[model samples]
Target chain A: MAEGALTAELILGTTEDVLRRYGPAKATVVDVARALGVSHGSVYRHFPTKAALREAVARRWLERWHEGLADVAHTDAPAEQRLRDWLSTLFEIKRQKVREDPELFDTFATLMRENLAVVDDHVTGLENDLAKIIADGIESGDFAPRDSKVAARAVFDATNRFHDPIYAADWKAPTIDVAFSAVVSLVVSGLSVPD
Target chain B: MAEGALTAELILGTTEDVLRRYGPAKATVVDVARALGVSHGSVYRHFPTKAALREAVARRWLERWHEGLADVAHTDAPAEQRLRDWLSTLFEIKRQKVREDPELFDTFATLMRENLAVVDDHVTGLENDLAKIIADGIESGDFAPRDSKVAARAVFDATNRFHDPIYAADWKAPTIDVAFSAVVSLVVSGLSVPD
Candidate 1:
């Protein structure tokens, strides 16, 4: 492989593939290089270290997970409806990742632990998306005026069980959807202006 | 020691000490037996297996943790006030455990994972306490008439981040208390019957 042709994105995709096949504990920078038909030095040029590579992979995966929700946050709908849709979409995305790609989900979860800054950034990004919708709600008089950022954080924290990976096992419960709906309703109710 | 002196409570207390000193992985039935000046055989007669002993210890610990909350659940105060007090108290108890005795807290968390049935039962017991408070609120017309059991579960799940061991690391953040109060206020607002 030509050295000039190897990019960070290319290296990250190969690393993700390596992680999927070998799992988090055994996957390494050398594996990514071998998969890319390049030397480990080439991969190092892109990621600098194994930790950096893992962090990049986790960040990219989390970024993709919330892209749809960002769109939902900005949709031209009633702020309440948009907030509901945004949260539901976010929950469904996480639930699907847990249910459908549990191996990859587990891999990212392990990576996320070692990459706390990336996880924090991802959470902050999602919270910002939530805050935008909440701010819109306040402007439209649908919700009571409050600190949108704080309200967003509260809403995000309130639904931790539905979206947080640590509670992934509980997501499969028969009543999980009902529980999710209940939380969303309560949160929306809490935000709504009293009639 | 007298044969009759080897009570289950004695064994459990010794086990907790052993666990706190040696941690969840290293602590064993033999250590508990050694600490109590009894044969491992005598301990086996009461707990049957190491797993059983660990489960019993975890159950006792969790039961103790919630004992005070059970009182708050049954208090004569306004249901809303009682509910807030119960939740805030529960959060404080868990936060203290995480901050003041992280090692012991971690050992219990590991033991709890191994003894999931014990964990589930403990959660159900706590939810029952919450349900009782919500039922009272409904009766007093402070909250809308809803399924108290379901509302209890929702409240418990919603506040999970403040109390769940996995999120313990985030508990020490400067804004955690504010974030927690925000969630509690949102939850209480959601439960109250709007005028």
Candidate 2:
């Protein structure tokens, strides 16, 4: 029923609030239940265990970024432009996540460390998005002939510094915008057909 | 005077043995002194604190890598070949570090996390070695006009998957070499002056 769907959505939304206030180490389902004014049993009904609850929270948080990236990947623009927009969208989403809800972002960062399988799926999904764009480019003759899968992974790894939380501290650096453009130019040029 | 020098060298060598035998968190100055069969006071004379001792060991271990990189950076060969060699050398070194003395490497990884200044200097030094090669390429017109420092950083960042310890787990992934070459080629092509 739609009521069941609303219950899960309400739990995930309240979970974010709890995590932001108490962080991963201390946040609990009871906290989420209290935030939602529901019994702890109700929270457990949605997520079987604490780990499941946390993992679902982590998955929900990550998918929001993917949704933005999906829009850019499937855009009607040229493949090259779509690739650029994809990277730009990814960078902007990460930067905004850090700036807008730093505490929640920090909580998810810890959750990511705790849940590698979730992180792996998230990375696989992102790389697949990149591959879709590169595949389009290869098909249109805009990109050099190559293994689109390998090339997509390379592009993802290449631009990791701009998006990975590991280098988040450098995002605010003064010359970062220039550096981002230079790297993007290099990537775009790399993919283009030789003159 | 040479006895004093030998004492410091002996302490450092024993510290490496101690750390390898018992990981970083458990290793201590007294343990290091005991390994060398010397008074702990003597170790303190050389390293004022446990942190200082660990910092020196980390610096010493990291410098060995830099020394190898420096040879490749300043090689009499062409800049493009040197760049290739440099990346190959880095991948091999990181692979060897994990394969050979994983415990010491693990200890240093933790030390690096604990000591940001050392990590900063090490990164700056590595980037400088990269910049030197890039500056040479720019001078010889092998590379296009741009900020050499920025380009150097991008190159370093681009090849990070092959070298950075954080991604050590993926270094052994099937098709990683293909991914590595794709990225290296992309970066090299990006840097080259168009025909």
Candidate 3:
């Protein structure tokens, strides 16, 4: 990575660490700067305000989430397995984020309503992509032609529901795979019709 | 109903109304007593403590919910139609509650983590009854046995997940019905195997 890109990643990592240890209310750019052994001016050079820093963290989280999705989307694997892999990755990311940095999780939930407008377009894009892939499967005789839109939404909603429970700072991966498999089986079999 | 039962029912209704108007933090026994035009002592006679009153309200909600499930479970109707009716009633109750008694919805959510103990047994009972009915259908060749426990839990969990957006005081029944139908269809098809 370039120098600036590397610094940004370092800043993001330190910011997440401070937030997890001290919570969003107490974690500031100064804290992140001090943690990084850098001056406040250096932190301010990259982030003008605390809110800006937090937003950057949020953006980084979103970007990483999408990257995980992209990994599954581009894989040369069966659609159903790809979908499960994607879900497992998504849940694991959420689980780890919560376990490692709970303050960010708290910040995310508190600000999700505010940030959803910015995030919705990307989320909608993902949902649409997944829907189209499922639809393709149905068309190719690999799956049944169900209401791909609704099926896609159910998968999206159910998988997201695991985030809150699985990411409790004292986290456990209990039932994550169980719930994921149940929903996946439901969707796959639900969509498959006999020839 | 007996006299004591009648009084309890009356108090439950008034308490729900008070919680609806004010939030959990503000809804107290005095407020409920005032709403019912009764002395605080009369309210106390029915519910000894504020916690007791809140528990009663939660219990009442679960009772009504299970009553709805019981209606469908005991019916001599087809398994498919019965499942559909049960899910529709579940979703519709959430829809109407979101609009009419948002306070009750709030109460349910506030107690969701804490007072869920009250509903645990009730939910277990409902799940058991549901599993038995589904198992009976499978034995009778009316439906396929595709993990009745998961299906029951899915129906239970999905109802909560899908209606959350609705219960957040959004009254979008059409979208909710679409999601609900998709989940139901998934369960139905997953369980259906060729003879």
Query: Which one is best on lDDT?
Result: 1
Q: In terms of TM-score, how similar is model 2 to the real structure?
A: 0.88
Per-candidate TM equals 0.97, 0.88, 0.77
> Any runs in candidate 1 off by more than 4 Å, and if so which?
none
Ranking, TM-score, top scorer first? 1, 2, 3
Higher-ranked by lDDT: 2 or 3:
2
What is the DockQ (computed on Cα atoms) for candidate 3?
0.40
Query: Which is better, 1 or 3, measured by TM-score?
Result: 1
Candidate lDDT scores, in order, read 0.88, 0.82, 0.67
In angstroms, the error of model 2 at A123 is 2.5
> Candidate 2 vs candidate 3: which has greater TM-score?
2
Best by DockQ: 1
What tens digits encode model 1's per-residue C-alpha lDDT throughout A1-195?
A: 899999998998888899999999998788889899999998888888888888889899888777777889888999889988988898889888888988888987888888989988988988999999999999988888479998999999999888878778888899999999888888888888978
**Candidate 2 ranges with C-alpha deviation above 4 Å:** A1-6, A37-39, B1-6, B139-141
Model 1 Cα lDDT, one tens digit per residue, B1-195: 677988999999999999999888898888998999989999999999898898888889898877677898998999999999999999899888888988888897898889888988888988999999999999999987379988888898889988787778889999888989999998998898987
Model 1 earns a TM-score of 0.97
- DockQ (C-alpha based) per candidate is 0.81, 0.57, 0.40
